[model samples]
Target chain A: MSDLVSRHVGPIVLDGGIGGGAMESQIRFTGTAVPLRIEIDFPHRMNESVVQDIDTAIDSTDYTDRLARQTIAAGVHRTGTCAAKPYASWTAARGERPADPTEFAGALTLRRMIIFPDGGRNNPERVAMIYSLPDTSDEHPIEVRFLQPSGPELCPVNVRPRV
Target chain B: MSDYDDLGGLVARMKKAAIDCYMAEDGFNPHWNDNQKYAKWGWAYHHYARPDANGEGGGSPLTATTTLEAQGSVAPRFDEIRSTIDTILTGWDTLPSGALCRAPQSSANAATALLGGAASVATVNDSDEIVRATETAMASLNDLAGSFVGPVYDKYCAQLLTVTQNLGTVYTILEAQYAAQQAMWPAAREDVVAICTSAAAAWEGRAAEIAAGARQDSFTVVAAVAGAVATVATAGVGTAATVGAVGAFASTTVSTLSSLDASGGHVSGDTYAEILASLVGALGALNETIAAQELELNRWLDETLNAMSTQLADYNLDAFTLADFSAGDGSSSINRTDTDMITTAMGRVEGALSEALRAAGAPPVSNPTPRPHAIGVGLAGTHLAASGVYDYANQCLQSTAAEYTRGRGLFDAAVADYFNTDAESQLKVTTLLSQEALIAEMGGRG
Candidate 1:
């Protein structure tokens, strides 16, 4: 398994998106010179499903291993900041007394959600998500921003399966 | 009198042309003289494919030992023909100015005394016979002189004039080709070097990005797989958590792949190689023209010698008639004007030559008829093919192609493979995640 070795040098801030179809989140890290931008978009149903799944995972339910369960819960976060806000609002939020992106000096992973379009009834397209987990920081929260997609359709144009 | 001077003038022109052919600027020098341009081209050719960092395998400059080999091929033959003409001219000057020999003075007093004393008809008739035979022999000597100094010399001189003009044409073509190359080479090298250097630097700058991107992409997939496996092994106990974790990881990998897309890591320094290829092609065209002209010249020289021999054979001087002269040289054909066949093949590359010249921005060649008298020499109607030109042309092409390949194909393939791998990993991860979702739904979970 490959692991990212770095610390976030800036606060997570929402960025504007392409015609309200996808929302972007950007954070800087110590290992990379450029800010990593995460674009989020999903159909309303998948959004509810993912949020409920996170809720279920975070539920105070019976579990043999509580640490692993809590670790998974801390890794996910939902934002009330509407992505459809004016570009100026997003920038203002990022500029308000710059929180040291390095405030959290622990291993962090940036996750993005990718949804493939359905081919046919026989070959249904499915959703898959990937994580950027740092090997040294399994305890640190894996940050995920579930942004509100304001577009008519959440799927990016022609998301091919073998792309 | 004008014809006599014309014949001498033709010989002088032939000599001048031959000497010019022997000299460097007038065409016969096969080795290219612009070392500065060559040095520039060599630098670009060798360094264009080199990576920005030191110790990368780059092209080495190609040698021109093959170019040097063309040195004596053309010039020495001109020298040999010039020397032969010089010998013939010198020998012409030593020919007898008067009758081949003085006939015994007609003794008038002895004739009168002998005729009055005995009136011997036999003695008188014998004297007459001696006079007739001497007259006939003298006339034969005069005819031999006329033939040597007139038709034989004139025909050969006329042909030599054409040959010299043809040589001049060759010289003009070679000069223009050389000039065009000189004019185009430096600019071409500069462009090539700048392109390669900039490309190499851009690629170098992206090294860190590509590495970070690759790690992020691979790490995400690996983490997702491990989480999925753990969830399955635990009998769906941590299945919801596993789905969340794997989904996050897959998204990270996808993001990294998107960022890394078109990151300039796969750029190649092929600009220089391409320029070298173009220059080599120009050189090949130039060399082919040279070979064609060379072949045409050889044919002209042969025809000139044959014409001279045919004209000279009609006035054979027997050994008995002129004690010091013999018809043997005139009776047998002389050696070919040029024994060396410079080119094994020939063709008209006029269109290609002009196009190459235009491409190089070379001034048009000054020859009125490039390949003059090609029809007269029996080459006008023939379809010809030629491949070898100064051996150096082939060497440049071969080496340039080999060197240019060093910078390009592999990098492109690598970029393609990177994308393909990324795509495959995405599909596999999505397939696994999708299966896990199906399993969760099948287990009567929300």
Candidate 2:
């Protein structure tokens, strides 16, 4: 993130955990009258709770790798799941077909979630919930992106143009 | 409201005129170049003007010329000419009583040596009445050399007085306008200060809520600014107090802002919103007051210059009109007589003196010889001095007009400078206070 974005947007925080407690991250930006704070919850999932599939799409990298690999414009790039990490990895049983359907590290699933505080536009207690689709193919992945829904972002890019 | 009022220009002009007159007394003095010749000629003319018995010389030959004409002693034309010369000389020498005159020391010395000395120095006119009167006029032209300013001042007195009054009026108008602005400033400033103080207090009331992380919103950013301002007010002694203030304000403002529905809008009903409206009103009024003051000052300057320009034009016309000194126009002198009259008188005076010398068996002379025959010399010398007076008068008038015109130009330049300076000042004040500028600075209405 650029200095300007860091000043207005929170740093991305991700936690690696089992299916027990839900980890949360916040992305807040200035809005008219009051600031709108966004809280995202990532629920942990146990390996046994995950459903078995013959063709499960998965990623083998850690959360940092996921973040780094994503195309993000340095300054005001508000895209990507700010908090995403490996939830569970899966491997197929001994080969009974073309291959065992597994590599050194097997299929992995990353979960993203959000909970809004209120429904009012100017309410300070407003919370939001966001969830990206879990079924992503090997060629494509989904990320939860934060948006400044209050209005246009009052960042340096928007404000410094005034004479 | 005012402009440069330097008295240096006026003082310098007066000083220049005084110096020119002083120099003229020396440079154009009839006897400055030829003292002895003038002394001799003045002696004869004075004697002729008043040839009395007892040899004190009180009787005038000009008075007797009419009698001489009736008796066929002189021609009628000569009598008329002599009368004309007498009239012109009477006007030329008409100075105020007790006026200083040139001392006739040179003529007196010459006369004393000629009449009251050795046989070689004695002349045939030793007891003649003509010789005695010659001594009188020569002692009186010292006053003539000193009379230039007096007549010139008298001639232009009315115009100069008008110019002076107009200058005074210009200053008076400036003072009045300045006083009016001064009177308006204190009240206007008080009103603005009062509004600012109230707005500050209202902002302070919300500072605790903002610092306590109550209504965390975009306004929290503004509250954080207020906290920082407070820290600055305490000169860094309140740093700890400012830390939480910045934290809560920044966190709450950003967090609250991120939840706003992209499709919706909200009108703030917060204390800060009211403060913005109040401040905008106060600043707009202040801007209007400043603009009004500028307009008032410029109006007064324009009016004063208009009146001054009109008067200056009239003064210039008078100065130019009176500059012509010719026989064809009667403005040849302040007394208003044709210049031809003075020349005519000069001719007659010379003619009479020449005939008198001839009748006395004195041969006509080329250069004046101190002999009684050289009475014709004084007229040219006296006329030369009079011409200097006219030239000096014309110069003074033209200079007065030029100076007045220069003063107007300076007044105009001063007004222009005042407008430029005031305009820049007003722009800064108005721009800083304008609602549009404030809105832009505060990240727009949102």
Stretches of candidate 1 off by over 4 Å are: A1-163, B1-145, B180-187, B197-446
Instruction: Say which candidate scores most in DockQ.
Output: 1
TM-score per prediction, in order, is 0.18, 0.21
- Kindly list the per-residue Cα lDDT of model 2 for residues B17-96, writing each as its tens digit: 22222212111111212222111011111112221111122112332222223323222332443343233223212211
Instruction: Estimate the overall C-alpha local distance difference test score of candidate 1.
Output: 0.25
The C-alpha stretches of model 2 lying farther than 4 A from their native spots are: A1-88, A91-114, A117-163, B1-152, B155-283, B302-446
Complex DockQ per candidate: 0.01, 0.00
Candidate 1, B168: how far from true, in Å?
1.9
Tell me, by TM-score, which candidate is best. Answer: 2
Provide chain B's TM-score, model 1.
Answer: 0.18
Q: lDDT, candidate 2, residue B153?
A: 24
Candidate 2 DockQ, CA atoms: 0.00
